[model samples]
Target: MQLKQALASAVERLDAADVGSPRMNAEVLLLFVIGADRAYLYAHPERELTSEEAARYEEVLAQRATGMPSQYITGHQEFWGLDFVVSPAVLIPRPETEHLVEAVLELARGVQRPKLVDVGTGSGCIALALAHELPDAEVYAVDLSAEALEIARANAARLQLDKRVRFLQCNVLDPVWEKTPDVIPSEDFSPSRGTCCSEFRDFDFVVSNPPYVAFSEADKVQKSVREFEPTMAVFAGLHGIDVIVPLVEQAHLALKPGGWLALEMGYSMREEVVNLLSPTMWEDIRVVPDLQGIPRVVAARKQ
Candidate 1:
């Protein structure tokens, strides 16, 4: 079938399923199936798709119709203007999280070879972005799920960033509670490997887009997100501060004096994040708003 006809059929199915942005979703799935870009699709609307291509397109459309995220279907997402591999094992990188990256860059402004840690580094988005921008900086990415860490490590390899950002499996950058992985004992990264101490110490920055969506607010989340995305990457206890609070404290221990912590929080989390950093131990705290003018990132420095 022609690309246009297949796309139209997919859009109709997705729309009937009550999916938002059906046309774009359909186009993405079709392009993914046919291995073509939007320009190619438009330039060759009458081009025929082979039987296998048509079948693949319809299969992805069916998944989208069932509320599966298009990103998950494509196994890819664009973050920091770079394509990242994604799966149900990790949270899909969102645009707002880029603000977290921006905040870190602004704060890290003139520092050379700064050391940074990304806690809850699902898909290694924040750490990879930072390492790309600051090639000389030491970047460490940690996550609780070993599965998520594997995908993150794979993404780093795909992007030629694996050599810069090291990946670890730990919750919130806490002291390694368990034994070390095979990568331990390397001088440059021994601490992140597993020492069970303040091995993560003295980082110039700590950044994260931690789980900030409250479980009670599940109804506000989109159908695809609730059903298809990983839940641990979304809900953070009742108030959503469950993870952020601990991350803030850990950022304190890991950061050197004058180091900064940059975090992306829920739109409703500005006050709580502010209060959490209100203590004298933290200073230069500031809130950054996204394009929508909602408070999307909060940055604070260790005192």
Candidate 2:
């Protein structure tokens, strides 16, 4: 079969399955199988596919038909114009998260070598991106899952950002208070080890796209997300503030006076997130909309 014919068939199948952006998905899959760019595929529409190549194309087609995300099948995702390796271990970086980065950069302006922490740093997307843009900044990322952290570490190495970004395995839900002088402990403690009391110090900035999907809204999510993506990165709680509530409080405690806190939240979560911030802790609280004009990012400053 010719490459063009195989691509057409794959796209048709995806369309039949009601998959959005079928043509784009088909083209990406074809490029993956043929190891060629879009130009090559267009210039050689009549090129014949070997039996092995045809079989591989069919396999990818089947996966896509089942509603698996294209990025997961391709093992890579683009965020902030840079490609990062992705897998089932980590949530695929979404375009909406770019706004969070932009908001952070806007706040980072004029700040010298700012210290930033990305809580629940899945795939290290936010932390690594910030480190790349702000080479002098001290960036630290933490996640509860070791498997997710492994992928994050690998991506940092791939982007040659291993030296700038640090990864730690941490469960943000657990009480972080260690028996020490500081408010937030500077030293890392193993979860297996007994908890200690340490003062948690303030950070220059704190940013996150923590899990905010409500349990009741699960049916509204797409199959690719609900099934393939990790639940730890998705569903929050009955009110979807399981992570957001604590994260906001933590950011408030972790940020130095006047430090900024920016977060990406669900479309229907703007008001709820705003309410999450107390007047005494956060000032200038506002929700920013994304390209789709949905209120997605909430930004504020510590008082």
Which one wins on TM-score? Answer: 1
The alpha-carbon lDDT assigned to residue 57 of candidate 2 equals: 90
Please, what are the lDDT tens digits per residue for candidate 2 over residues 41-67?
Answer: 999999999998899998998999899
Model 2 TM-score relative to the real fold:
0.92
Stretches of candidate 2 above 4 Å error? Answer: 173-176, 179-200
Q: Report the Cα lDDT for residue 227, model 1.
A: 85
Q: lDDT for each of the candidates?
A: 0.85, 0.84
| Residue range 1-303, candidate 1, lDDT tens digits | 888898888888889999899899999999999898999999999998999998888788888888888888899999998889999999999988998998898888899899998988888888998899998998988888888988898889999998898777766766532343432332335645646454678899989889889888999988778887888899899888889988987788888999999989888888888998857799888999999999999988899
Q: Estimated TM-score per prediction?
A: 0.93, 0.92
